[model samples]
Target: MPIPDGPTTYRELAELLRGRIEGGEYPPGEKLPNIEELMETYELARQTVRAAINQLASEGLVRTVTRKGTYVQARLGRRRVRRNHVVTRSRAGMYIFPAAAYPDEPWQTHGTPHRSMEAAPEVVAEQFGVEVGSEVLRRRRVMSPEEEPPFQIVDTWLSPQAVADAPQIAEKSTGPGGYLERLEEAGHGPISWSEITRTRMPSAEEASLLQIPGVLPVMEMILVGRSGRTEDALEVTIRVIPGDRVELVADLVRDASAQWPLRTAEPKE
Candidate 1:
C-alpha cells in the first residue's frame, strides 16, 4: 500500500479505497481488484482506478455486478435512533394517529388510512419552504418492520397549521407517537432537521409503493421537518427506502480548518 506520490486525485483515490474498505482490508462480499488490478495495485491511472470505483459506487460502498465484478455492499446498519433525535417507543408511538382514532382497530383495519393528498412536486415545493400553490398536506404512509415486508413509503407534508393541530395527521398506525411526537403534540416543535439522501428511479407509483423488485434501487429519503420557534417549514418527509432495508445515519462533526466548499452550479442568471 505505498501509492501516494505525484498527481493521483479521485479524491485521493477515494480516500485510499475508503481506508481499504473500512479496514477489513476489503471483505463483505469481496471481489474488487479489477480495473487492471486497481491499476496495478494503486500505482494509479486507469482513470484513477475508474474514479475510485465510481466513488465507491456513490457511497453505498460498492456493488456493480454487470458481468459480475465490484462486490462489497452491506454495511450501513447502526442507527436505531439519534441524530435529529425525535424519540418514541411504546403505546404505539411514532406518529400514526388518525384512523378516526382507531374505529374498529385490528391495526386500524389492516392498512391504508393516512391520507392528506395534494401540494408538493415542484421538487416538493422547493423542499417545503412552500408557496408553489400553497396548501400542502399529502401524508400517505406504510411502515411494517418486525420481520419486514411493508418496507416503508412515507410521503408526509403538513403545514395547514401543522395539519390543523394534528387532526391525527390523517392516521395509519406504526407511529401513533413519533413524527417528533406528532410535532410536539401539534404545537409544532421540531426546530430544524434536514436529511436529503439519493439513489432513485422509482415511480410506477414508486415501483408499486416500495414492494421494489426490478433491479432494486429506491433509497430516496427527503425529510425536512422544521418549526421550533419559527424556523417555519413544518414537515416534508418522502422516504421510499428499501435499498435492501434502509440504514441512513449521518453524524459528521469534523472541523480541521473547515472550508467544505463544493457548490455545483445554481446561480448564473
Candidate 2:
C-alpha cells in the first residue's frame, strides 16, 4: 500500500492506525499489523513505528503485553454507580452490595484494608467539624474486581470514640451489618450521609496502585455519615473510582431547602 500524501511522521502513522481502529477495520482484541509490517506499509523507520504504537498505548486504545503482540483493547464498559441508597444498599440491609453494577456480569470485589490511627488532616477536621490533629481511625482499602482491574480505592475515617469497641471496622471484611451497623451499636447510628464528587488525574502512586494508564483521571467520592440532624459527622469515607470505568447517576427532586443536585456537604476550603 502506498503511504498517504503527507509527511510520514509518527503522529501521522498513529492517526492512520487510530482511524483503522475506530473504523472497526481492526476489531477489539485483534492484533494489529506487526511493527515490521507497519514500518513497511507506512514506509517508516522501526523507531518511528514503535513510537506510533506507544502513542496508542498511552491513549489506552491498545495494549502491549510481554511476548504477546499488541492488540486493540476492548472498549471498557462502565458500571453505573448511583447516589441513591436503593442502588447502594442490599435488600438484606446488612451485607455490602456487589461492586459489579451489571446484573449480567457476576463481579466480586476483593478489598484489602490497611488500618491505622492518624491525626486528622486539616480538610478532614473541617469536614468532621473536629480539630486538626484529633485522633481518627483511618482505614485505606483497595477494592479489586475479580478477573479485571481494580474497582476503587476507599479511605474511611471514624472518630476514635465512634469505633472504639468496633474492631470489625478495621478488618478486611465487616462480615454482617457492615460498619454502619457496628457504629450504630456503638451509639453513633448515622441518620444521613452526604458526598462530594470531583475528578482529577491520578497521582503516580494512585495510578500504580489502581493499575491504570497515564493521565486517566479518577472520580473521587467523599462521603460523610452524620448523626441525626447534626453537623458533626460520625464517619468520613472517600472512594476513588477510575473515571473510565464508572458512571454515577442520582435522581433529583426539586426542593427549596436543598441547594445541590446531590446530597453533599459544603466543600471545605
Candidate 3:
C-alpha cells in the first residue's frame, strides 16, 4: 500500500489508526495489524508503529496482549454521575449512599471495607483542619460491576470529632443510610457537601486494583461533608474513578435575571 499523504510521525500514524477504529474499519475485538505489517504498510519504523499503538492503548482504544497482539477494546459506556447534592432515601426509608449510578446494573462492593485508624493524608488533614499525620478514621471500599474490573474506589476519612460523636461510623456496618445517617443522629444533622474534581495518572497500586493501564487518567473527586455546627469538615470522601468508566454531569440553571433568548441589536450600518 502507498504511504498516505501528510506527516509520517508516530502521532500521525496514531491518528490514522484512530480513524480506522472510529470508522469501524477495525471493529472492537478485532486484532490490529502487527507492528511489522503496520511498519511495512505505513513505511515507518517499528518503533514508530509501536508508539502509535501505545498511544491508542493509552486512550483506551486498544489493548496489547503479551504474545497475541494488539486488539481493539470494547467500549465501556461512561456512566453519568449527577452532581446533585440532595441526599436520597430508599423506599425502606433508609438514606442511600450514591454508589453505582448505573440503573438496573448489578454493582457490588469488592469486599468489606478496610477500616483502620491511621494518620490522615495531606488532603484529608487539610479538610479536617489538623496538622499532617493526625490520627483519623479511614475506610476504603472498592466498588465494581459483578465479576468486572473495579471502576471506583471510595475512601472515607472522618475527623476525630465525627468519630467521637458517632462511634457507629467506625463499625462494620452503620445500619441503613450508612454513616451519614449516624453522624446526623449524633447532632450533626443537616449535613452539607462540597466537591472538587481533578484528573491525574493513577498510582501503581491504583492501576493494579482498577485493572487499568497507568497511562489512563483517573478522576479524583474530593467530597467534603460539613455541618452547620462548626467550620471544620466532618468527613471527606475521595472517589477515584477511571477516565474511561465514568462522566460527571451536572444540571446548570440560569439565574432569574438571565433570559434564555437575548434580544438582538438592530443593524446600524
* Number of the top TM-score candidate: 3
lDDT by residue for model 2 over 147-232, one digit each (tens)?
Answer: 77677787789866566556777666776777887767766654467667888777776766776654567888777777653446
Candidate 2 worst ten-residue window by lDDT: 95-104
Q: Roughly what TM-score does model 2 have, to 2 decimal places?
A: 0.63
TM-score of each: 0.29, 0.63, 0.75
Residue-wise C-alpha lDDT for candidate 3, range 1-269, written one tens digit per residue:
84668439999999989999999999988999999888888788888988888888889888676688888877777877775666677786675555437555788797677999888889999888899998889999899888676889988999999989999999988887788888888888788887788899888878767766667799898889897567569999988988888777878888866776875779999
Show where candidate 1 strays beyond 4 Å.
1-25, 29-37, 40-48, 55-72, 75-123, 126-155, 165-237, 242-269
Instruction: Compose the digit string of candidate 1's lDDT tens values, residues 90-191.
Output: 455544321111123232111664665685776577766667876576767676544434555777777676666666655554254555676675665654
CA-lDDT, candidates in order: 0.62, 0.72, 0.83
State, as a TM-score between 0 and 1, how close model 1 is to the true structure.
0.29
The true-versus-predicted C-alpha distance at residue 154 of model 1, in Å, is 5.2
Ranking by TM-score: 3, 2, 1
Off by over 4 Å in 3: 1-7, 16-50, 63-72, 80-83, 97-100, 103-105, 133-135, 146-148, 260-269
Higher-scoring candidate on lDDT, 1 or 2: 2
